[model samples]
Target: MAQAPPMNVLEISAHFRVEHDKNRRQFSIRLNGSHDKAVLLYDYVGKKTVDLQHTEVPEAYRGQEIAKHLAKAAMDFVVEEDLKAHLTCWYIQKFVKENPHPHYLERILH
Candidate 1:
């Protein structure tokens, strides 16, 4: 059987999208889409530290690690854009802890 094409992460205006399907339900993580929703926001001062926020996933999508994918996208963006983060969001903090990438944290505004 021919294999299905892998889902290429789609980059939106300021975010990335990874679609998902679960038991007839469709969902996705709109990474860095909107700070009011889930996005990367910079500080008022140096504008160096960006904050990441992820809303509680829908009931059907809970415990599915969609947030991790979103976080990874954020981290990747940080590197690609050469930006730093404050990690105000809990999930993002945990992600930085697990990844141990210095590029993101080292540039943090102290």
Candidate 2:
């Protein structure tokens, strides 16, 4: 049997799709080559002020900047819905701290 070739960043990034499972209160991305691979995971607080509770990227997906995409998606959703946000997730907190976009910063719960 032949092994599949490893995906390059552009190839992998092109296939990336983030989905919000509102029922589960999570935002996630499925990896392209592995069924068991969860590229990113983010859970949130669903109250008046949505608190981003946790974020995880499987070890295999780390260093690929996948978490950044997840953070942006979650923050964009919060902004679009006109909801406040609390960055309780350390990864998200760090991402926001580093990127500091005005739109995301404005909605943050200080």
Top-lDDT structure, candidate number: 2
**Displacement of the residue 110 alpha carbon in candidate 1, Å:** 5.3
Instruction: Estimate, for each residue in 13-107, the C-alpha lDDT of model 2 and write its tens digit.
Output: 57676767665667777776567444334345565678787778888778888788878788887888898988878888898889899998999
Q: Each candidate's TM vs. the true structure?
A: 0.55, 0.77
Best by TM-score: 2
At residue 7, what lDDT does model 1 achieve? 44
Which pairs of residues collide in model 1? none
**Number of clashing residue pairs, candidate 1:** 0
Instruction: Give Cα distance to truth, residue 77, candidate 1, Å.
Output: 1.0
For residue 23, model 2's alpha carbon misses the true position, in angstroms, by 1.4
Report residue 99 deviation for candidate 1 (angstroms).
1.2
Q: lDDT for model 1, on a 0 to 1 scale?
A: 0.53
Tens-place lDDT per residue, model 1, 1-110, is 98664444444334336543222122246534543222233232335445554434545555756566666766665677577656666877887788877776674543
